[model samples]
Target: MPRPYLLFTQHGWADTNQSMMALATALTAKDEAQIMAPCLDYAMTWLRIAPLIDQVETLATATLAQQPELPLRIVGHSMGGLIWLEVLNRHPDWWDRVDFLVLVASPVGGADLGRILDPLKVGLGVAADLGKDRRPLAGRIAAAINTLTIAGDIDGGSDGTITVESTRVPNAQFVYLPGLSHAAMRCHPQVIEHIQDFWAGKRLSEPLIPHPLVNRLRQIPGMTDAHLRDFARSTPWHTFTDGTSIHLWRSPFGIDHVFLASAQGDCLYAGYVGWLHGEDLRRSLDALRGEPELLEKPIL
Candidate 1:
């Protein structure tokens, strides 16, 4: 007989554990699973995230101690996903026990709105913590665990809050559900369906193969992904040989924002760099100009 599931469902900032609790029940209705859905203090969520992570870790550790052999299946929404990433990062020993991980509308690339609220990186309530980019840590965890990321795109690129781009990470399966808002994602039926598919070892969609230009842009120092809500204001600059293109937009404060678009006019990436990495961004763009394969090509 297969080992029973050791399941965990975590709620995000300013959220009660009720939604996740319902999610947990739905996910394991037919299976023999032990579920742990901790109700974090809603008021405390407005502060830092470290204390919250510690709280969850303590509960998880004690639960594992009792049944150390059961394979783990975790589901996290928004901040909940970030917490699990931190927990998994601190305990590599627990990596093997994690069978599956699902991040529902989590911002793995950092929350763009959070950066706006705390531009100076000050500990402005929970903004600074929410704005942190945890992709590197997520990448480390994904290498060892079977990971799936579910993002809702109510607009062209965002789920009314989290951008689809921000939810992406390397080496993980991605499911993009159009027309779904952020709050609706918590216990959406489609979200549940996709998670069930993932648990059954099914591919929800084709693996995302990022454009080569995206890979190059990511290597630039201090480059951070941004939301596409402001993409309409940007001006087209250059189009590459592969029909990929670049657009430019400068904030009133002189901050540079860059965007990547496909030949089909679909937005592929939106990112920005602060003054510290301005020079790096320029040099990277200049280098791209010299490469014929990535050079400007007129849109026909």
Candidate 2:
């Protein structure tokens, strides 16, 4: 029997294979293909895209060698998208290997926020890559293969991290989603649907979720913070994503209160910052049904 299509997913800055796994789980549900996700390190004092791309190139080359006849589909987010642009540009032969490509809120233009820290040189590598006028391979990418660009927008503007303008690529089809953020784009149900549809040859149009519910998604940064929670809504509510939701809030008085709740409002990861809560936190996470990494990881 022929092998299933090989789906590869690359994650953005500071994120891990965990986030991409959720999408992979959904995409491979029909036994259509096996998915692999590679992670990049954007930790403090160390950040560079070249090495990251190199790793992907190596992976792609090796994967294709093992299964030369299998169809390939790639999905990249933020920096991950930038990495693939270079991968295909550098390895022109991979063109035939790829059956479909998807870029989710990737910042084809470049992320302006990176400039805010340019002086520190801490994240300049990524900042320059995300700039709108900074991407050189963008046009080449669109020319070689049909690519879909997905941009997320919260109510105010931008996907909380990436601006719609930054996500745009010349000569490429663009889909703008309301009530979605950069992080949310990686795991949002609607976002996933659009990507799956695109893979199935559907034009990227139609908004997945309503504007009102979009406002309440936990994809927004600081959604769990005391200040942001109080500001965003008057009534207490859980985030839109499934699994156990945990938010560590620090009071003005310096007391840290950890709030944990299920998608149905059941407490899952709650604790006081004082002591002996690590084990309790881990125990709670053990019962999580969907994407626990979304709850455990710090939301930047």
Candidate 3:
């Protein structure tokens, strides 16, 4: 007989476990999987995330101790996904047992809004923790586990809260639901259907093909991907030979936001860097100036 599934569903910031539990129930209606949905304090979510992580870790460890042979399936929404990433990073031994992992509307790439709230990174409540980028850790975990990232694109780029670009992770299958909001993702029918399909050996979405300009921008340290909705406000900075254009927008806080637009004026990529990475971004762009194929005419 096949081993029973030990399913875990986690809710995000300012959310109760009710929606996640409902989702867990819907997912396991046929398989009778064991579900673990912890009710984290809603008020406490405004604080640091470490304590919340500790609570879930302790519960999961105890449950696993009792059922050592059960296979694992995890579903985390928003901050819940971030918490699971940290937990898995702390326990590599749990990797082999994770049959599947699903992150719904989770910002794996540091949240831009979070950084905007706490621009100085001074641990101002939960902003500092939420602003942290966990892609490297997520990439390592994805390399070892069957991972799926589901994002909501209500505004062509964001889920009304987290940017679609911020939900991306390396080596993971990605699914984006149109007109879905961040809060709606926790129990959205389409989101549930996609998850069910993914588990049944169906490919619901394709992996994004890497773009050369985007790849180079990703290499620059401390860069956080932003939403494309703000691209209209940015001024054109440079235009490349391939019709790719770069735009710049400085935030009121003096942070530099960059946008890469395609030949047809589509926002291909958008990212921002804090004061610390200002020089790095400048030097990287200057280096791109020397590449003839990349730069044809300067619009600055």
Candidate 4:
């Protein structure tokens, strides 16, 4: 069983519950923990920022009211942590209520690229306004909880998007994985130990695994070497002609949610999809590239 914590999982960009389910299974091995992963879209998507902020506040308030006895702990992956930070910024009082906050391969400050492209998104109207204001959001959240942050040095200082400098908060405990990629560090056994130790309020003695490439993957948009390491555990081939098949394996490439459309073709959608087929679609997305692969998989 996992520890008796709220176990709120914040996934990366475009991710739904697909990635969270795998994490919940691993973290709750002891069975003592109950995890709740909500359906969250990209923070920049889904209308304006106020509504998005309200979404988390509403959920957190409900969770706090219902599970008063259970220690509330939050774990966010990538942009998911960014959303969590947004929530905390709105309601700082909730920070004291939380036990521990564990951010896996999360870009706390801001993704280096985010700084560059964010303007384009806002300018071209591709995404909602996500400015430097989000950077301070994480710092505010850290003030509320016993925050623990993990960053990968594989790509300078990014899990892939947010830079390490972006993730730095004034008082939060920080750990830098010199060689692990942003996403790969999520599956590293050392990451598990750090998460568990923080939950138990213990300090980590040594990293479980300190493989390099953590920061190296920052060079690419969706190619995290950490995915290469973690990929073997689920499926060797991620790109598949069939979207459903791709979801069977954990996706190494970054997407919001993994999904396979009902369309009849030798292709699997790579981007975002609902539950069930999330893992199934990621299994077959090994061949395609960029956003096109996100929604439609090509036949091999």
* Clashes per candidate (backbone, < 3 Å): 0, 6, 0, 53
Candidate 4's residue-wise lDDT over 213-273, tens digit each? 1121121232211222222234323333433333224344533233222224222222222
TM-score of each: 0.88, 0.63, 0.87, 0.58
lDDT of 3 by residue, 185-212 (tens): 9998998899998877787666544457
| Model 1 ranges with Cα > 4 A deviation | 219-223, 229-234, 239-243, 250-255, 263-265, 273-284, 287-300
Ranking of all predicted structures according to lDDT, beginning with the best and ending with the worst: 3, 1, 2, 4
Candidate 1 lDDT score at position 22: 93
For model 1, give the RMSD to the true fold.
4.1
- Which stretches in model 3 have alpha-carbon errors above 4 Å? 1-3, 219-222, 232-245, 249-255, 261-266, 274-280, 291-300
Best candidate according to lDDT: 3
Give the alpha carbon lDDT tens digit for every residue of 11-111 in model 1. Answer: 99899999999999998988899999999999999999999999999999999999977989999999999999999888899999999999999998888
Model 3 deviation from native, Cα RMSD in Å: 4.1
As a whole number from 0 to 100, the lDDT of residue 274 in candidate 4 is 28
Q: What is the lDDT of residue 152 in candidate 2?
A: 82
- Which has the greatest TM-score? 1
Score residue 67 of candidate 1 by CA lDDT. Answer: 93
Cα lDDT of all candidates, in order? 0.87, 0.62, 0.87, 0.54
Worst 10 residues of 2 by lDDT: 218-227
